[model samples]
Target: MQFYPKGREQRLSIHHPSVRPRRLAVLRAAGVNLLLLQFLFLGLFCYIFGSLFQQSTHIHQVNVLFVDYDGGAIGEAVRDAYKKLEGPGFPTIIERSASDYPQPGSIEGAVCDINYWGALYTTANASNALTAAFAGGSAASNYNKNDVLTMVWNEARYPTVVDSALETTLKTLSQSARVVYSKVNGKQALQNLDTSDSTTMAIFYDPWTLASTNLQPTSQGSRLIYNTLVIILIMIQEFFYLGTVNGLYVQFKLYTSVRPHRMAIVRFIISAVYTLAGSLCTAGAIWAFRSGWQVNGNQFALSWAVLWLFAHLNFLVLDVFTVWLPPPYVPMALITWIITNITSILLPFELSPGFYKVGFALPAHAVFQVLIDIWSGGCNPQLYYALPVLFVYEILGAVLSSVGVYRRAHYASIKAESDEKACEERVAAAVLQQQEVQLVRQETLRDAEDSRSSNEEQETRDARPRRGTVTTIKDQEELVDIIRREMSRPTVESPEDRRSTTGPSFSLPFTE
Candidate 1:
C-alpha cells in the first residue's frame, strides 16, 4: 500500500538526515516503482474493468412497457406472444399497461422517465384495420391508418445496445401479431409468411411499416462511445492513479534529498513512458476485438498520444494536491474518480442528468471527445473545443505543480529544520527542569525523614531515667565512691569470728 523509507538503514548508521539518497538514486527507485512495479494496476485495469465494459455493453434486463390501446385481437395476441418469447441471458421484464390509444403526443412524456427501453402500443380497431389487409387488399395498402402495433422508444435514454434491443423486440412482437391475425381470420394464404418469398412479412406485417411514426430515429454509432472509448479511458485512468499516488510519500522523498520539482519531472517522464506503453496496449486490444483492422491504426495512436497527454496532465494536477494537502489523497482520488468517471464517461452526458455537463472540465471528458472524433473519422468536430480545454488543464496543472514545489521547498530547507531543532531544544530544556524539580522533592523528603528519626532518638534518650534522676548529683558521686571503697576493703581479723563460733556451740540447731 505504501513505500516505506529505503534510506532507513543509512539513517541509522549516520544520524544526520542529510545522508540520503541522491537525486538520481531517488529517480531510479521511482522509475522502477512507476514503470515496472505498476503492472498490477495496469493488469487489473485491463483484465477486470476492461472486461467489465466489454461484457456489460448490453443491458441484462430489457424492460418493456406494453401499452395496448387497440382492445383488439391483434393487441391481445401480441401481448400473449411477448410473454412466450424468452431468450437466453436476462429476460425482458414486460409491464403490460393495457389502455385505449393514449392521447396524441402524451406517449413521449410517459416514456421519458426511461425506466423501460421502449413501449409497444396499438391504435383503435387494431383488428378491423388488419381485417382489410387479411381480405386481400393491396399489399401496399396503408397499414398506418389501420389497427397496427406501434413501438415507441426513447433513444436518449440509453445507448445503441438498448436501441437495437428495442428494435428487435418490436420486430418480434410484429411477427407475432401478424401470425395471430392471419390465423384468427383463417387466412391460409398468409401461412407462408416464413417463406423467403413472403411479401407480407416486410410490407404488411413489419411493425415499422405498420406504424412508421412509432419508432423514433436515432443516429448510427452514437452508443459506441459509452461501450468502447469511455470504458477504456476509465480503466486507463484507474491504472494511472496507482502510479500518481507515489507522490504522496513526501516524507520519504524529502528524506531522500529529492526536490519536489525534480521529482515531478521524473514522475512526468516515467508517466509519459508508461502511458505510451499502456495506451498502445489499450488501443491494440480495442482495435483487435472491437473495431477490427478496417479503421486506420494511425488514429488510435493519435488519440492515445492526446489521451496520454491529458492523463499526465491530470496526474500533475492531482500531484499538486498531494504535495500541498497530502493527507486527503485517498479520498480525493475516490471522489474525483466517481465524479469524473461515473458522471461523464460511463454514463454518457446525453443519457445523464444536466449537471453531468460539469465534467467537461475533466480531462477524461475532453480526451474522450477527441478520441471519439478520431475513432468516428472526425464527425463530431470536438477537437477544436476539447483541445483548448485540455490545454487549459495542462497549463493549470503546471502552475499548481510549481506552487506545490515552492511550498515544499519552503518547508524542507535548512532554515526550517534549524528552527525546528531550536524548538526541540527548548522543549528538552523544559523537560530537564521538570526532572530536576522531581529530584529535589525526593531528596527533600529523604532529608526530612532522617531529621525526624534523629530527633525522636534524642527525645527518647532525654526521657529515659538517668542516674541523676534517681539521686541528687552530689549524692550520686558519693555513692559511687563508697561502692569503690567497699570493693577495696579486705576481710576483718578472725578473733570475733572464733568467739562467735565457740558461743554458737550452745545452740542446738547450729550448723557445723
Candidate 2:
C-alpha cells in the first residue's frame, strides 16, 4: 500500500470520526468527573473551615466558674457586672461565700473571685500587704492563697467575654466610677489622694484588657480558596486537553496520512468548544448552588466571570505546552504546579519572595489576585490589570500553539514523504537486484551450453574416419546390398540439415 504524503487532500477533517468522537469523549469524561469532585471537595472544605471559625469564637462558653469573696456593696457591683455578662449561650458563673473558700466539688466552668477594699485598707496599706505576701510572712500572711487561685481562674475567662464587650462599656464605667468616688470622698480629699493610686480610687479597670491582645487570626479567605479552585480547574483542563490530543494522535497515526498540524487544529477547535461548554456547565452549577443558599447574586456573577476568564486563559496556556512538548505529561503538570505556586495562587502575593514577582506578571497571578480581592471585599486594581495580561497570555499561547501545530504538520508531511521515498527505494532496489540475478543465471546457462557443445563437437571430430580408409563387407551378398543402399542415399545433406548441424556449434559460443 502506498502512503500518501501530507497535502491538501491528506488533511484530516475537523469532523472526522477519529478526530471528533475521541476528543469529545475525553473532554466530556474529564469535565464530568472533575466537576463532581471539585464541587464535593470544595463544599466539604468550606463546611469544615466555617465550622472551625464559628467554634473558635465559642470556646469560652464551655466551662466557667465564679466566686465572690466580699459580700459588700463593692462586691455586689462586681457580681452584678458578672451577671449582666452571663447568659444562656455563655459560661455558668457561680458565686461562692468566704466560708466556702475551697469551693466544694468542682465548678462546671471557670471561677471568679471578687474582693473589696475597706476604709482601713488604704492604697499604701494594700501595697504593703501585696509586697509582704511576696516577701517574708507578715500580717499579709493571712492573704488567702485560695483567693489568689480563684482570681487566676477569673482572669483566664475574663478576656473571652469581657474583651468582646470592653470597647462599648469602658467610657461609661469610668464616668460612673468617678462620680461615685467623688460623692464618697469630698472633692478636696480626692484631689489630695494620689490620682495615680488605683488601689485607693474607685477606678473601673477593665481586667479583660490585661488578658486580651487584639490579634487577628490566621485564616484562608474566599479569595485563597477561589485561587486554589482555579488551580484545580486549570489542572482539569490540562488533563482533558492532553487526553484528547493523545487520543487523536494515536488514531490518526495508525489509520491515516493526515498532517499533525491539521489534527492538532481539529483537536484544538473541538477542545475550545468543549471547554466553553464545560465552563458554562460549571458556572451554572455554581449559580444554582448560590441561589439555593440565597447568596448575593452580583457577587456570584462577578466571581463566576473572573473564574471563567481564568479557566479560559489556563486552557490556552495548557494547550500551548501540551501541543509543543511531546509525551510524559509529567512535565506539563510540573510546569503548571510551579506556575500556580509562584503566582500567589497557593499563598499571598506579598508573602511570596521577590523572585516570584515575575509570576505576578503572568495572567494566572493577576487572576488570582483579583479573585482574592473579590472574595475578601477590598479594592482590587489588579482586576483591571489582569484582564489585559490575561488577554496577552491567551493571544501568545494561541499563536505559539498554532505555530507548533503548523510545524508539526510540516514535520509530518516531510516524514510521510521521506517514508514513501524510502518504500519506493526499497522496492526499486529489490527489483533491480532480481533483474541482475536473472541476467547472471542466463549467462551461467549460456556458458554451460557452450561447454557442452564444445565437448560434443570434439567427440564428433574424434569419431570421424581418416581420409584413405576403406570399408570391407562381411559377406558378398551383404556387401552388394550395403553398396546399393549407400549408393541410393542422398549424395549430400539438405540445407535444413546443414543449418541444424552448424547452428548448435556457434549458438553455444562463450566469451573469453
Query: Best-fitting candidate, measured by TM-score?
Result: 1
Return the TM-score for candidate 1, rounded to 2 decimals. Answer: 0.42
What TM-score, over all chains together, does every model reach? Answer: 0.42, 0.41
- Model 1, residue pairs in steric clash: 69-99, 126-147
Q: For candidate 2, report its TM-score.
A: 0.41
- As a whole number from 0 to 100, the lDDT of residue 30 in candidate 2 is 66
Tens digit of per-residue lDDT, candidate 2, span 128-156? 33333333233333633223212222211
lDDT digits (tens) for residues 1-512 of candidate 1: 33545434344433345534454455665675456325645643553343234232233356656666767676777756666665533226465544432553455444544445566677766556555544444633555533366666644233454445556656766776567655664455355333343434444444334453332333445345644455546444734563454644443545236666776666567656765676666666665555223357687678678756766676666666556654524343444454445435554443334455676776666776676556545534566778998889777877787676667666667654775577556555555565566556545645565556777756644653353243334444554456446643655658868665634212111111
Clashes of 2: 7
The true-versus-predicted C-alpha distance at residue 340 of model 1, in Å, is: 3.5
